[model samples]
Target: MIQLQSIVKQFKSKNGVFNAVDHVDIQVKKGEIHGVIGYSGAGKSTLIRCVNLLERPTSGKVIINGVDLTNASIEQLQQSRQKIGMIFQHFNLLKTATVYDNIAIPLKLLGYSRQDVEAKVTKYANIVGLSDKLASYPNQLSGGQKQRVAIARALSQEPEILLSDEATSALDPETTDSILDLLLEINEQLGITILLITHEMNVIQKICDYVYVLEKGKLVEHNTSIDLFTKPQHPTTQKFLNTISQRNLSDSLIEQLNLTGAVIRLTFVGESTGKPLIADVANHFNIQPNILAANIIELKNGIVGNIVVHINGTPSEINAITKYLTNNGVQIDMLGGTTNE
Candidate 1:
């Protein structure tokens, strides 16, 4: 439903030219929840802004539903934006306007009739679970409630694509979960293509079908959420994964263990998760497997699992065990320990 082709957005800084969004391309299918992740200054916000032409790109194409929005005229761009809704980290509600009016503003500006505007406002307010707060002002609502108002306002236009720029970052963990759940519901029920930006990996893990990792304005990595989470390739990607999982064996632990035998990181996906894969592997190879650490989590796609183990055996036996696990669909990575080979 949305495609960004070789998109670039550069700014003239006192130091020199800076590219906030470097050459990046993205494709989000219809009804898919796509996530973009990066830390502060990662260009995620700027890239998202390019989607709606809020920040005009310096080069490349912004295509939505096969129409090149990059070359669209003012009126065309305005019309196209009607189908592209955006919400921010901060709830951008008019402080003085009531919830009802805040949601109605877009429709009203589009020349919607009073009756139509009223109907849309009420409908979206209920959709975002804020019908009771229709008369409440921005200051009267909690952070979560204010976000609901922002969501209602965005949905008032019935956008086909929702761009969420750190929409849940300001909420507490519980509230963040609620907001993520709501986004999932919206994607399932409304079939809106969602492109969300977040610094939180857990948020991406919870809702994204596909993920794109950005670093210093460049697209560093892209993959299905399950694949990326289970076997992240890039160093930057690994760092992001570390936020949700304990990844490294401390120098002290390695030293205390004498760094003998092979320490392997095993990742399991699909039906392999929660099974006695480790025990089976040990028994099959006739090798002792000392489990160092393990983590398992359920994602929207499937169960993903990771485990670290210290295996002691002859070189041939260790090689055979690795092959055996590979045949059964376990992803393995040697994390600096002992590999007889």
Candidate 2:
């Protein structure tokens, strides 16, 4: 439903022209929750802003549905923007306006009749679970409730696409989870496509169907959440995954170890997970395996698991075990020690 082609947004700096968003392309399918992730100053916000022409791209195309927004006239662009709704990290609600009035602002701006505006605002307020708070003001609501007001206002336009630019970054973990769940429900029930920009992997893991990794204003990698978690290709992607996944043994820990066996880390995915494969391997090779650390996380696709173990055996036996694990779809990495490849 949304496509960005070779998008570039440059700014004039004292040193020279610097690109906040370099040449990049992204395609978000209809009815899917696509996430854009990066650290601070990585141009994630710039990229999302370009979608609604909030920051006009210095070069390339911004296409929504079938319309090329980059070249559209001012009137055309304004009309088109009505179908695209955006929410910010800070709830941009008018403090003086009541909850009902905040949600009715968008409809009123479009010149809707009073009866129509009230009807639609009531519907959207219910959708965001704020029906009871209609008479409340922004100051009286919690952070989560304020966000609910922003969401209801965004949906007041009945947008086909929702752009969330760090919408959950300011909330606590429990509040964040609730907001993500609400977004998923909006996607499933309202059939609206969502493009979320976040730095937190947990947020993406909970709701995103696909993810695009951004670093230094460039598209580093993009893939389904399961595939990306199971086998991240880019070093940047690996670093991000390590933040949520179990950390590797530190050099200090490794130095303190007093084992003479080889240490290996195994990653399992899909059909290879949830099995006593470690025990079976030790039994088959007639070698004892000491489990060091392990963790299993469930994703949309399936289970992705990791295990670290130390084992002692002859070179020939280690070689056979490596081959056996490889054939059985287990990824083996030599963390430390001399192990057969």
lDDT of 1 by residue, 1-341 (tens): 89999999999989999999999999999999999999999999999999999999999999998889999988888889999999999998899999999898888888999999988998888988998999999999999999989998899999999999999999999999999999999999999999999999999989999999999999999999998988788898999988888766766787689756778888889977867878897677777798888888677788888888888876677778888888888988877666555
Error of 2 at 146 (Å): 1.2
Model 1, residue 76: distance off in Å is: 1.0
TM per candidate comes to 0.96, 0.94
Least accurate stretch of 10 residues (summed lDDT) in model 1? 332-341
For 142-209, candidate 2 gives per-residue lDDT tens digits of 99999999999999999999999999999999999899889999999999999989999888788888
After superposition, candidate 1 runs with Cα above 4 Å error: 339-341
Top-lDDT structure, candidate number = 1
lDDT of 2: 0.89
Instruction: In angstroms, give how far residue 207 of model 1 lies from its true place.
Output: 0.8
Q: What is the C-alpha lDDT of each candidate?
A: 0.90, 0.89
Candidate 2 vs. true structure, TM-score: 0.94
